[model samples]
Target: MYIEFFVNVTSKAWALPILSSLHAGIPGRQATLLTATGASRTSFAQSMEHLIELGLLERNPGHGHPLRPEFRLTEFGKESAAIAHKINSVSQGEDQDLLRRAWTLPVLASLHTPGHFNDIRRSLLTITDRALSQSLKSMESRNWVHRSVNVDARPPRPIYSAINTGGRICQITAPEISFMQR
Candidate 1:
């Protein structure tokens, strides 16, 4: 359920950064959000429209000019923003890049405990094997995940575990799950 929420929220290229900016208390004006998130003018506008369409944000009809509107989070947006903030706080470089992709967070969360490929696949039921493999490879390259071989097993098997950085990402994101339960 939360994986679906994460994918929906991150569907737009600028969505995550915009949410992070809003959660950081940046003003909701178009110019402010664009500047704060460093999103291109076109991308910012499109993301704003997409967010409103998703019912995560709403314009304060009388607050600003139509061409430079102001927006505020709906109740749902607030919860989503909180999650974005938590994810953003723990990420850097490639990790941040990975978080913007759908299924990345779920994959990382599954690795909070060491797991083999099939173990993670079962945990994130909706992910494709190709997508999981790609995400894991990307994460390993970034050093967020460590892949080791278990040669002692019948046929050598690969094991994956979240390294310190990845574990911290999971730890930080844990609160977002608690928020959802509330």
Candidate 2:
């Protein structure tokens, strides 16, 4: 459920940033969050609506004009926001762009213990082979993931593991993500 939570929450490009900023104590008014997240108006609105739909956020009923309403985190939102804040804190510079991708964090979360292609695909039921392959290759080029061949395997399979910043994030998140039974 925890891993799935990330999968849902990260569906929007600005979700993590918005959650992170709110968790960091930035005011939840639209203008403040918009400026802090540096998200464009349309994407930011979409992300905010998505969060609200997910029950992670809700408008503060008594605050601000309707056109520029304030928002607040629900209890679930707070929990998820804490995780988002942790992820946001560790990501730096170029990594920021990669982390914003829909599949990246969920994929990294599954890499906590290192897995083969099939293992990862099984863990994330919704990911396509090509998407997983592309995400792994991209992270590999960034040095966030380490890929090694298992020569002992009959077909010589490639194993993937999170390293460095990716490893740290995995350590932080994977323990909390409940893996679904096969």
Candidate 3:
């Protein structure tokens, strides 16, 4: 679902490449491929840090040096990635077009309030402003949501609301039944 919402390609390029590199083994000398793909080195590095912090990956100890640690996927990490890939494949269905606009839980929760993007973002932490803006535009284009811009103050803000609630979970695009179907 995240893939559909964040179709920037850059994000995919950043994530998939690293995942593919680690597909066969862990603690591989994979930095070269990360550099060769023209992926944002900084973003890729940051993601590694974030993924590690998430406890999905871990560095081995003893033989491993502190600065140059060997990494491996935790059981939870591998299972989660596997489940994500499988679910993502299922969500695309045969047409696959709808798959590009995946929705996240926070985005759905934001729509629940109907007119509080700020509150939604605060509730959803770590979502970048650029990503939120891009997602709002995408959601509006799809007619899945409605937006009202408020510019009475120094910095303008927009509030988003869902148009339909049937089968909706947090966001309209992410229907509640979709999980059961999976």
Over 1-182, each residue of candidate 3 has an lDDT whose tens digit, in order, gives: 33222222223334434443455343433465365334566766665665576555676556456655566667756754443343343322332232233333336435656666667566446677777777666656655568887788558777787653211434433443343233
Report the CA-based lDDT of candidate 1 relative to the real structure.
Answer: 0.80
* Per-residue lDDT of candidate 1, residues 83-124 (tens digit): 777778788755566766766677876676799999999877
Model 2 error, position 42 (Å): 0.9
What TM-score quantifies how close candidate 3 is to the native fold?
A: 0.42
Candidate 3 ranges beyond 4 A from true positions? 1-28, 32-38, 60-70, 87-134, 139-182
State the local distance difference test value for candidate 3: 0.49
Candidate 2 Cα RMSD after full superposition onto the native fold (Å) = 2.3
Best by lDDT: 2
TM-score of each: 0.84, 0.95, 0.42
* TM-score of candidate 2 relative to the true fold: 0.95
Minimum summed lDDT over a 10-residue window in model 1 is located at 173-182
lDDT of 2: 0.89
Model 2 lDDT tens row, 4-45:
777888889999999999999999998899899888999999
Q: What's the best-to-worst order under lDDT?
A: 2, 1, 3
